[model samples]
Target: MTRLAGMMAKSAVAPLDRLKILMQSNCPHYSRFNLWSCYRAVLNKEGFLSFYKGNGAAMIRVFPYAAIQYTAYELFRPLMRALMGPHSHIGNFTAGAAAGTVAVTSTYPLDIVRTRLAFQVKGEHVYYGIMNALQKMFHENGWRAYYKGYAATVAGILPYSGSSFYFFDLSKRIMLKYFPKQTTTVNEEKGGRLELSIWAKLICGCLSGVIAQTAAYPVDVIRRRMQLIGMHPAYDHYNTAMWRVGVIVYHEEGMSAFYRGLSLNYVRAIPMVGISFTAFEFFKQLLRIEEHAPTS
Candidate 1:
């Protein structure tokens, strides 16, 4: 059910994700194009399915990514809470970061395939499909190619996931304090665990998405840039050294360059997180799924 919720959220936001990747990696075809123009270009050129170009690879990565992330958070939060106090935001953040790291490490190579697949321009393709993309990278670029942006991804996930689950747990605490009635009774079996109402979950998710995305976005761009190395001519010379890429982006396009696709990302992320959290909560509540106690 957690995986299902994550899939529901990821599928809905895929197009925006594609566009964000295109813009962030500075896809030459869509260079200097605004959001609408890029959408039109994708629609006109490759039909609707092109909007979900790498969605298959995304699914492959996201299943384990989301499952492990949420599950690990559940497992780690208790440990963190044991170490920190019940109200420690630092505990929540650490659990989230640990979860994100575990998930990313397990599924990162598939992420490279996803980005490379997204880089393909239907007619002029670098990779034709998911399997082909994996095979091509393995054959041509070798094992090291699979982890091009790993360092950046690891660095970025800390804050992104940290804030994400922190806000989630924090919101639960805040809501329980201010709107005690807003929490559901679904977690009674989990030793009086507090579960937020579905609406509360959705709202919490949106706020979390906005803050988390904003915080980690520039690092995301760096990771995307690193992943695109050799996928496009423009990115062929892009540095794999994460810091070097950050420096180059600054030199070439100034600080604003780091946040090129951020607006579109927010457009995608807001609802993405909202739906994901809501779905997870709704399903968990509906099925009476038992999870760890919510931090105080």
Candidate 2:
């Protein structure tokens, strides 16, 4: 009976352990609240339940989106580290940026869907599904439409995801410094995994999120403008190009407009970052994998 119980425990432990490893290594890639936060801000004026606007489709999209992103980063990290060297933070940053780009590229369509859903008003016409949106957007705008905010998105991604990798590592190093005896990993023979407290992880994650968001918020605003389905009609003569978008936003909305949703972004960022980082570190420790976490 004891042996059977032990075997069952081992089986359970294996998947749980694997999950932890997956989160830490790929958390930045998979874990996030960008679309959700955007939706929430729109809904806040209408009602409390607004955040779930496209949640059903979004939830469906998230799994694959996350899966592709995490998997890509996992595959890319080693190549990046090998080529650039593990000790180089620049290598880590580049790996994170590249990983983010790959992940975003794989799931950009879904991201567009999520954004459309978030931007939807109750009576407004919204695309029915991924294919419909793609078709309609292309028919109306051309190929460039699909990648509407690609520049700002890519720019925002670099610092946001890059910082995540940087700060998480920095925080971990800080922890290790203070707690000299703490072990990030454990030998199964001795007992089991060594997990960092949720609080500690959250603090570090929040800090990472804030730093990254601060660096990238202006670009994010421009990205939103570019992504809008009907910005031209509303804003009139606004430039579609990224540099032009920045100029237009500054011209109309002024400098403050570039920081739209700043407070809300931070509110959403703290927990989002915490979840992403915590999940990531947890997974990394569990898997005993070493890789750079993205700044996002």
> Scored by CA lDDT, what does every candidate get?
0.82, 0.59
Shift of residue 275 alpha carbon in model 1, Å: 2.3
lDDT tens digits by residue: candidate 1, 1-296: 66766676678888888888888888888877888999899888878888788888888777777778888988998899899977688998999999999999899888988887776777898787888888888886798889889999999999999999889767766776677765654556656756677778788899998989999999999999899887666876676578988988899889988888899998888888888777766766677764534444
Q: Give each model a TM-score.
A: 0.90, 0.72
| Span of 10 residues, lowest total lDDT, candidate 1 | 287-296
Off by over 4 Å in 2: 1-49, 126-132, 181-195, 229-232, 288-296
By lDDT, who's the top model here? 1
> In candidate 2, what are the lDDT values of residues 1-296, reduced to their tens digit?
22233233333333222222212111122223343443343445445444444444454555555556556666766787798886567776766677777767766666655565545444454576567777888887787667767777888888877777667667766765565245344447435534446567778889988988889888877766566645225433444677887887678657866665566566656765676667666666557674433222
Residue pairs of candidate 1 with colliding backbone atoms: none
Looking at model 2, residue 198 earns an lDDT score of 58
lDDT of 2 at 190: 33
The TM-score, computed over Cα atoms with residue i paired to residue i, of candidate 2 is 0.72
Candidate 1 TM-score, C-alpha based: 0.90
- How displaced is residue 111 in candidate 1, in Å? 1.1
